[model samples]
Target chain A: MGVAPRPPAGDEGLSALRRLLLQPEQRRIEELGERLDDPRLRARDVGRVLPEALRLSATESETGESLSEALAPTVETIIHDAVRRDGRRFADALYPVIGPAIRKAMAETLRQMLQSLNEVLEHSFSRQGLMWRLEAWRSGRPFAEVVLLHSLEFRVEQVFLIHRESGILLRHLSAPDVAFEDADLVSAMLTAIQDFMHDSFSSAGRQPLDGIQMGDLTLWVEQGPEAVIAGAIRGTPPEALRGVFRRALEAIHQTQAAALREFHGDPAAFETAEVQHILEGCLQARYRERPRRTSPLLIVLLLALLIGSGYWGFLVLREQQAFEAYRERLDRAPGIVVTQAVADGDGYRIEGLRDPLAVEPRSLLGDAPLPVERLRFRFEPYQALVPAFVLTRARRLLQPPPTVDLTLDGGVLRLRGSAPAAWVEEARRLALALPGVTALDDGALQDPARAELQSLRADLGRQVIHFGVDTPRGEIDTPSLTRLADDLRRLQALAQSLGLTPQVTLVGHSDASGTPARNRALSGQRAQWLRRQLLELGVDPALLAVRAAGSDEPASDAQTPQGRAKNRRVTLDVRLDGAGGETP
Target chain B: MRKKVCLLGAFAVGKTSLVERFVKSLFNARYQTSLGVKIDKKSLVIDDQPLELILWDLAGEDEFVSLRLPYLRGAAGLLLVVDGTRPETLDTALMLHEKALDEVGEVPFVLLINKADLAESWHIDPRDIDRLVARGWSVLETSAKTGHGVEEAFVTLGKEMLGAE
Candidate 1:
């Protein structure tokens, strides 16, 4: 230090540290530059830092050079870079090649594992006594060439082989593509190889790349498709070998970028550039062609069809509206019109009156006159709400029989009525008839007895008889009612029941009371009473026509009490009376 | 129609021998384990309809007692085999029946006292076989070696398998 004022440790120290920490190579170059500038300083620096293991010994050489002199700069730079800039730039420049190399190494490892699995399966299958060789073996026929390839994007690279012609002793060598370093490319290549060769073992003859042969070679290999390039060679031809390499290289290049872009998200410069040009070309070509179409005939035909369908639909809709309107008018207008009402010597008679109010207003308002469709009317005898089996021939023994809305408790049926005297006998019979009905209490309306029967007879054919009976006692004692119910059960069992059938009528009668003002009301009550009693018996009330003639036209003298009693009783009088009036 | 029922057993326990006797009324000296399950179908007139009875015959393996369990599913009836001469084969037959019960649940079964032509030297007692019958198992004594009782085993199975009263 005293002899030389040794250069500032600051610059020297920094350079040495930089060499050790960052670019050691650059640091070594700098050290070399310093030594060339001054020989004495370079020799002193080498002597201070040289390790004992690298120390110059007395070992002689023809052109002797010290070990420290030879590696001294390199050591100096390594120390200097430890203090200089970080070395990421150098690493960045090296990565593209390194990354692919690593990926390729990993894919090769995986391919080897898959090949081992296939070998194991083949050995197992052959040992199972299932597979038999189908082709004959000639004395010198080359063994079948089994080439296992690692693939990428349908591009294959040979990775393994087994040859039958070479016997079991021929040594096989592996020559992997050094440039192929993509894992995704390898996977695609494998898939394509498997798909191509799955059923290859079963082929009968050799084709290009389908089989292998001896020195008079019949080796089939896929070389860029068309030039199957089938040829015999005594040994491997240099040109043929070169051609194989070229085709394989092309396949590798094709699948490499494609598989990378597809699987690893790598973009190709050429692909990006050509894509837009191809798209523009397609668009320009399409514009020049301008797809020629049919004359306006298609549009005209379409419009015609649409309009025709619409017109047909409109006609259907209008017809449907007309039918719906006709139905509405029919429902709104009563089927029969009453034109006149007259009270004559026989009874109060009425005439049919047709009114225009019932017609739809739309028809009247429309400009054109529409034809009216006439209505057809039919009358059928009314059917009972309840079946006949529950009643049977049990109406004769009732005492204070049940009436409408009566509640039964135990053996007692309760009736609440204020009907006239003509209806009393009929009411009594009805109350006694129903099964489970033993007694009755009249609490509501009473039946019209003998007093008002005459007016009821006049309106009988006009108003339908709708009758109902109550079983208030809740228990039946009558034999006929039990027998009827039994018969109904048997009919259900034997399929003998009348299902939804219509029947004829049996008209029943009751006498009338005097005094015209009260007679009409009393007569209506008597007819209602008889209808209820008939319903209580097995005879369906729907199949019965009951009418009352009040004492206005009594069957016997009203002055005698015995005549009133006979007239007040219910009597059966059958009739076939289906007319254009009320349905009974 | 001929109602076919298979007799399955261990090697030399007379499965093929029994089938030969039943089909042809003759003894078969040679025997082999069936390679795979075989099917035989026969028809029986029930309520005037020709009802088909299909029987599946399985190969005999040492592990067959275990493998036959899954094949017993949907089987109408089973005919288990035991060698009357050697008592050990009876255990294999019992194992098969128990496995069928475990997998198929109480299917109707018949046990065969097979090779009855050699029954004079048989070691298994009659009382043990009776115990099985008492527990609702059907027992039939057959001689596949002599064609004795082979027809009766199948005819009895045919009558019982169809629910024919």
Candidate 2:
């Protein structure tokens, strides 16, 4: 075998070729074998692949579930053991995650409650609420910000600024109505507790006790280099309260640095207003805003007021309209003038002018359902000159006899009924004097059953015996005087034909150019001259009488020369006495 | 002026009874504390100056309960009480005095030998108290049962605390 090694040079090439060909495979196979043989390497390899393997297995649900099922009891036991060993550490570890989860659960619970705020007070959306909202909007702030300023989230009942080294109460401020123990004693006790806790629990005493929670109250301590400020809060405080305390303590440290450092047991050096103000700032509080409950009685009263006002307003409106319609009706009524229609308290005062002949004002309230007692009226009597009312006034004032029918057309009075001569003369005078009567015409006349007497009086009254200007004897109408003398002899013959007594009177009229006394003397001389002429013409002297009617009841318009001449002439007259004298 | 004054003593030294005779305090204040201490208040007008001494009656130092050094912090003065019947209580009070000095640096203090009414069998030698007195310590013999020297002891301590400030 020793001699056989010399023949392996060519075989060395074969070995080299074999090494190149199978070395990688050989190394890999050795690695596999070593991994199987040594548990440490095998475990390392398995550990490297375990995650990937588990991932792949997990994709296949069967192996993943089985693997987890196998691990469940051990994991449970490990967790139980861990919890049993140091539950506080476990709790602290879970704190970060548990807080939000619990908060979310609580939020969900609150959401599920979904209490509807349907019973909110009526004043919430009332005018006052609108005003409040307007104020908030104008200020450009949140409603809650405006409201929560006075609404306290928490109250810091007491604040104790304590000396660091001595634990003496340097300055203290407390909220109103908050009862407390002695501040010095409390300060000492708190410092002792702090020391006790530090000595008992802390490996290093640099960290001070921060807070103590006690049933709706919390004691917060903020430490500074020389002083510690403690706040006793009576409710849940917001996180911003931390910054408040920090800032307050910072201010105190800056301003009261000397007082804090050189503080003795007297505590008088820290009693200045600035330090007190700083401490008072530490006594922060948020006042509570109580939810105001709506009073049922108040609501009822408001409702009653609303309904009562509404009804009263409706009645007022209706009454106003009714009064308007009534006023319109009254205004339209003829001869009624509505001067003032005023609305008084719960009623109307209507003042106007009313013709006595017009319809009543009260009767005009036809369809309006208004209280009769609530209406007032003041009407003054007035005479309306309307045509119908004028006729009525004429009829009332004149009191014309039925036999003498009276008619008025455009203020002209026309009388056309038989009557005695004296009655006819009186009616003519009175009819012309009536209101709104401009003229009178009464020529048609016939005595009842006495045609001759009526014709004789008409013929005699139509004749005119004229006289010269201002003289009785000058330029007399000879033929007219002779005819008037003859008519007077006939009137004496017909006086017995009339049922009533008649008289022929020589009446004289004079021009209105002269004075009444001269005109009356001239008219009487003319009438006496005419009577003497008629008496010389063989007429009965007692049947004719001379009278003077000077410048009155002119025959025509007096402003003309012809009317003046006619007014100066004399005419025959007839009269019937009230007692029928010389009746057949 | 308010001052913090501590009562340091051995067990069964009548420190509480001495404080009760010297001050009016809320009795329930002791039950309110979970710590081994009680608080009382004694107001006095020393030299025409109004002084309020907040008396901290610490629990007696014994085998079962050790003195908590933190309670001595901020103390203006200390009342070192001893039982006249037990000689060892004086040593305990002296030890507490040194402990209090270590916690809160040098302050005024008074040594009170309690139960002096029963001094017929008193175990403390008057020479030891005289030795403490010669070292410039204010010392007094007090009787809680008869209230002898109780008010004077508190007033003396109050005056010292007020003067120290």
Docking verdict class for candidate 2: acceptable
TM-score (chain B) for model 2?
Answer: 0.94
Candidate 1 regions off by >4 Å?
A: A1-584, B1-6, B21-34, B42-51, B63-68
True contacts kept of each: 0.00, 0.43
- Candidate 2 local accuracy as lDDT? 0.79
Candidate 2 structure quality by residue, lDDT tens digits, B43-149: 88888888878777888999988987777877889999999999999999989988998888899898999898998989988899889889999989999999998
Q: Where is model 2 more than 4 Å wrong at Cα?
A: A1-152, A204-206, A287-584, B24-34
In the order shown, the candidates' DockQ scores are 0.01, 0.27
Q: Compared with the true structure, what per-residue lDDT tens digits does model 2 show for residues A16-86? A: 99999999999999989988999999899899999998788777865765577566679989999999999
lDDT, candidate 1, A490-520, per-residue tens: 3222221212222223232233344554554
Native contact fraction of candidate 1?
A: 0.00
TM-score of each: 0.21, 0.42
Candidate No. with top lDDT: 2
